[model samples]
Target: MKTNFLFTMLTGLLLFTACSEKPATTYTINGTIPDNSLDGKMIYIYNRDNNNLNIDSTVVTGTTFTFTGKMDTAAYCRIDASREYYVNFILENGTINLDLSKPVSPSGSPLNDEIARFFAAQDSMSDLIDSKRQEFMKQTEDKEERMKLQKDFFQNEWKPAYLAMLDGFFDRNLNNPIGGMALNYMDGYLSTDQIKAKLSLLSEPVRNTPSMQERLQRFDALEKTAEGKPFTDFTIETEDGNKVSLSDYVGKGKYTLVDFWASWCGPCRAETPVLAEVYNQYKNKGLEVLGVAVWDSPENTKKAIEELKITWPQILNAGEKPTKLYGINGIPHIILFGPDGTIIARDLRGDGLKAKVKEVIETK
Candidate 1:
């Protein structure tokens, strides 16, 4: 995005004298369509939030098109030329200059600039994997050979490099809106400690933002159960009004697998059969599987278990205590506990659960 001629002149004069600190207060997007291919295309600026489409649009009249609007806050906007592909830009109150035939990086909005940097980082990440995959493909005609090459590259190299890049980016940009935006993207990629450490590095202004604060709270919840930490204890009521504590189920002289799930959760439901198989195979092998149903009624929990034929011991109507204790924000938060009651691993599912159970219980 490019600043208006008047605004740019005023900004330059202000910066020259170091006298004014006012900001640009409107948004302008200038586009160069460049060919008859898109001359009749109806371009749209889509706002992802509120499920809004074409909050603004322009029909290409010739080789160029432009859009101008007022905005109180900066957000990500998609320039949709067609369904298959689109360009993303930060919608800020400033002029954004673009040549559709060239790169989509816009200049005026600082938020947009930061967003562009983050995206470039992402593209670089993808490019590295693509390069490795292509190199492997060129050397091998076997389908399985190419598959292993791609898998090895991603699992061994992509994650560590991408995580290190993210760590540096998050560390460097923790004082602003960009830092706030980056937190949501850290899920599943950063470890519990990495998330906590990086989040703490964020400046107060960014950390104080409501969303950031909420994310911090969530990180707080999960970090308490970090792998290798002792599992916190909690109790739940059974259908017969008996209070069954976690100590009764876990922390025994066996590896305990706590399956935090809900009856309505589809993924959790799908994982029941896997749980059943693992439980059947390992129940007597110093491995115990415990089900804790949360956010679902005792009736439904019982019904689902019966229908699914899950014979494992379950704590119904477990509610939020287990989640809060475990710092779990999502369902199917499986935690593997050592016999001494320390948390061994978390978020494992399906084959991961079975493999981990075998690795720990059988291999020992």
Candidate 2:
């Protein structure tokens, strides 16, 4: 009886252990290059879904490098080298060896060719922008014309090429590994308006995907913030603990210049004298200026305020919370609020700020 009981206990323990254990899943990649210089170079492996887990280059030894990591299943993987070489591979639970000497394409699909073409086009567009910039600087004496040319290069040449690349990738394979990575890259650079324009070009099926849906939502939120329609009732505390709000300043029907800046920002510092002059001139004529300083320590900000002789109510030490609330990412950001607490203009600087302020107050 005792022997039987011991046997039963051992069997149960073994069964539990077997049920709980998970199989080790790893991918091993090895490569050899003809050039001895390729040895000791770094190779990077990127996971498509979790971008934060994107691993850096694995050191190459004798023109060979091996990467070991547990993947959930056979998913998309990108192998990058010195010349920006990319290949998509299905990483199974076993060891997979890759030889650079042998031609091994990503996923053995024609879409890789399409991606390569798109990258070539991207390079071409970058070259075009550089060339246009040089020409604009040489031929144009007007600063406005040069700025317009720069904007057009990005809006027309650069942006259209990027959109074309995305459309081409999706057309080839909706679930392409490279396509997903390209989409993430686009999200980083493109503005809200540019993204919306690109999304309008995508097919219905691609638009309906969960990833695309989330991106669209982000674009919408950003667009709304950029419009500055929601920054009403702007308020902050002064360094002396005095509670100041836009409502109190603009209460008696006065135009307010809600300036967003910081002491550490060089551009903001440069613009301070101009702002002070404008404020001094317009303060008696129903103009109120409020400087909202972000991302600065209180002591440093106080010193700057004294040095710049800023007499207006300055809000210091709001950190990033208020800045994000107002959707302000850049320093030297200025917003013109009408008497009714509605945002009339945004990011006005130097002559632009002066022009807008004069136009609004004079018209009123």
Candidate 3:
């Protein structure tokens, strides 16, 4: 009878202990924005999957708001109050107090000191690039010399420092909220080879996150596409309703540049003249250029073509057809195809474009 009682008591104790263990850590957020106008604004905390925790404005009698939620783990959370204001915080199982008395700066949260340092380093680099630009403008009359100088600066000085900063930031805090922003910036500014080299340094955990995995896939696709590999192609209708297939242009037995741009894009406009010059110089040497204008109105596109005096074959009014085909997220994207319809180079700009074209033409 005593043994039975003891067994029952032990089972009850274990059940009670299991039930009493703390629930997953929930962060209680208190935000105090001194300004009365901001009282009733909606705040959101987002993760990589666009999954977000939303908090409605607290009662405006006092300029303070509260939000409570559980984070599955230690991860980066983006705190946003509409499009104008945003701050990123590293959220764990603790109370988070946000004092938004001052406007959130583009430099990001001052609470994370390392993030501040990263921003400062980026600012310094921008200043250095500006100084270099001024120096180059002062000394160079020859276009080739200026191009060489710019290339050298990017490859040797700027790239190395940028990479070092990226490495340092990751080393300090692999889960830094600014890491995503930095990776995005690097994706745009660095070549596939450079990005690949840097990505090899990241820890497996960091590389395996959903966001990082997407970036890795993009980089892989870019590298494969740039190396003259087979890629999916599509057709789009021009303003005149003429179907233009990427395959149709490949029969010319020459290297082709498939350019993605838009009439409304300022960068595309600036690049038009450069492209025209390159096209005129190399047209006789078996180089063909095809422009694909995305998200452009027919009238605006016609005006741009007329203003630019572009004679190359172009396809506009394609809506999102070409964008989806190329997996294009950003504008001024270029993909070069060799004679056999295999993609050769991608995202080439300015002198890099010229150099790649020259190399391909010379080999042929």
Best by lDDT: 1
Q: What is the C-alpha RMSD of each candidate to the true structure, in Å?
A: 10.0, 16.7, 13.8
Clashing pairs in 1: 1-95, 1-96, 1-97, 2-95, 2-96, 2-97, 221-327
lDDT (Cα, 0-100) at 242 in candidate 3: 75
Stretches of model 2 off by over 4 angstroms after superposition: 1-67, 71-124, 136-230, 233-252, 306-309
Candidate 3 lDDT, tens digit per residue, 1-364?
A: 1323323433321221112445446766666665567566655666642334442233333567776666554455566654544565555444665655433222212223344455556666677678887788888988889889877876777766666565555544544345555665677667667776766665565566666676666665555555557656777766566777777776458888877888989888887877887888899998899988888887888899999898898877767766655656678888788877788887878888888888988778
Report the error of model 1 at residue 141, Å.
Answer: 7.2
Residue pairs with backbone atoms closer than 3 Å in model 2 (clashes): none
lDDT of all the models against the reference? 0.73, 0.63, 0.65
After superposing candidate 1, which stretches have Cα over 4 Å from the reference? 1-21, 24-108, 116-144, 155-157, 160-172, 183-187, 218-223, 236-245, 252-254, 262-270, 295-307, 317-320, 329-331, 338-340, 349-352, 359-364
Top TM-score model = 3
Each prediction's TM-score versus the true structure? 0.59, 0.57, 0.68
Answer with 1 or 2, whichever has the higher lDDT: 1
For candidate 2, the TM-score is 0.57
Candidate achieving higher lDDT, 2 or 3:
3
Which tens-of-lDDT digit does each residue in 1-364 have in candidate 2?
A: 1323323433321221112335435645555555566676777776543442465357778766776666443345466565534454544444555555433342222333334444445555566568878889998989999999788766755566555555555444444444544565576576667656756665565456455665666555445645446444545676677876656654357788877788889999998887888898888888999887889888988899998888998777767655655656578888887776667787889999999888988788
In model 2, where is the ten-residue run with the lowest total lDDT? Answer: 10-19
